[model samples]
Target: MTTVPRRFEILLVAGFTESDETPPTSAHALRSAVVEATGETGESGYPRYAGNGMEADIDPATRTVEALLVDGAEIDYGLSVRVVAAPAT
Candidate 1:
């Protein structure tokens, strides 16, 4: 039998409110999620979206990054990224 410690998965989501702009992506688009280390509260770089006064946020509990634009606004496009942990050998 093999023992494995419990880990978390991170995901990112974006919502557009009738806006014609490309969604923002992680600075490290290559690698999205990271394993939570011992007391590791690392912060990732969130680049500006054409300086449109927009910013990205993350929810550690839900492990999700959501845009704060949910006020009866029409979300045209959306993106959901699933981050999976590597299998143990």
Candidate 2:
């Protein structure tokens, strides 16, 4: 039997911390980190950073920040990469 290539949708989740002296991480910085680690680039030889409609769920109890991958292509502990099967048309 012939092998069929499978399509996948990759999602990345990361967590960070900031203090009174330090500012929050920027999208560009996150994208750059991902590119540096994975070597995934776009047409401009760099990954796209999308912050539109980006939502973050912060839990005070756990002190965690969770966000869903929404727009654009292309994060930190070095990136939690999740690859899932693409939906069929």
Winning model by TM-score: 2
For the record, the alpha-carbon RMSD of candidate 1 to the native fold, in angstroms, is 12.4
TM-score of 2: 0.27
Sequence-dependent TM-score of model 1: 0.22
Question: Per-candidate TM vs. native?
Answer: 0.22, 0.27
The sequence of per-residue lDDT tens digits that candidate 2 reaches over residues 21-73 is 53333331332111111222334432322233232232223323343343422
lDDT of 1 by residue, 1-89 (tens): 64232443333344333463653344533324333323322244221111122223334344344432222232335544433442343
Task: Tell me how candidate 1 scores on lDDT.
Answer: 0.34
Point out the worst 10-residue segment of candidate 1 by lDDT. Answer: 45-54
Model 1 Cα shift for residue 43 (angstroms): 2.8
Which pairs of residues collide in candidate 2? Answer: none
The per-residue C-alpha lDDT of model 2 at residue 1 equals 62
In model 2, the runs with Cα more than 4 Å from the true position are 1-4, 15-75
